[model samples]
Target: MKKHEGLNCDDCVEHLYTYLDGELTGETESDVRVHIEGCGDCFGHFEFERTFLRFLEARAKAQCAPEPLRRRIFKEVLLDNGSEAE
Candidate 1:
């Protein structure tokens, strides 16, 4: 482990999302990277969060509805709105 530097656990928590998202740049980014690598708790939290984010990203991808099914849904909507689907 290297020096703790200016970032404590609290600072690490605050920067967690931004750091993981690759949004942090320059020294701030370097500091958080170093802190996570050096601190066991922070490293574990980073690992868990990164995994969860990957899971969410995988499940959250938009899939287009099939055109026939989409038209059926639109027809239902038009009927409910008192407009005939011609």
Candidate 2:
């Protein structure tokens, strides 16, 4: 792994989300990637976050509510707010 001359644990943690989401620019991404590779703790945190995002993605794909269920929820929300679902 190439060493990121100025990257450190704090910087890596600060940009973890952006890094995982592929929102970082090329240079920033490289720095964060290198930092994570050399820092065990940061790497573990990155892995955990990555796994969590994947789990959420899979769960969302698998558990989409049907149209009827969505309508029911919308009606329920309207009723809960004292507005009838006409």
Maximum-lDDT candidate: 1
For each candidate, what TM-score against the reference?
Answer: 0.67, 0.66
Off by over 4 Å in 1: 1-4, 62-86
lDDT of 1 by residue, 1-86 (tens): 64545599998889999998999998889998888889999999999999999999888876668899888877777565565434
* CA lDDT scores, all candidates in order: 0.86, 0.85
Model 1: per-residue Cα lDDT at residue 13? 88
Q: Which pairs of residues have clashing backbones in candidate 2? A: none
> Over the stretch 1-86, how does candidate 2's per-residue lDDT look in tens digits?
54447587887899999999989997888888888888899999999999999999998889667999888877777566565434
Candidate 1 — what's its lDDT?
Answer: 0.86
Clashes of 1: 0
Candidate 2: C-alpha RMSD to true structure equals 6.7
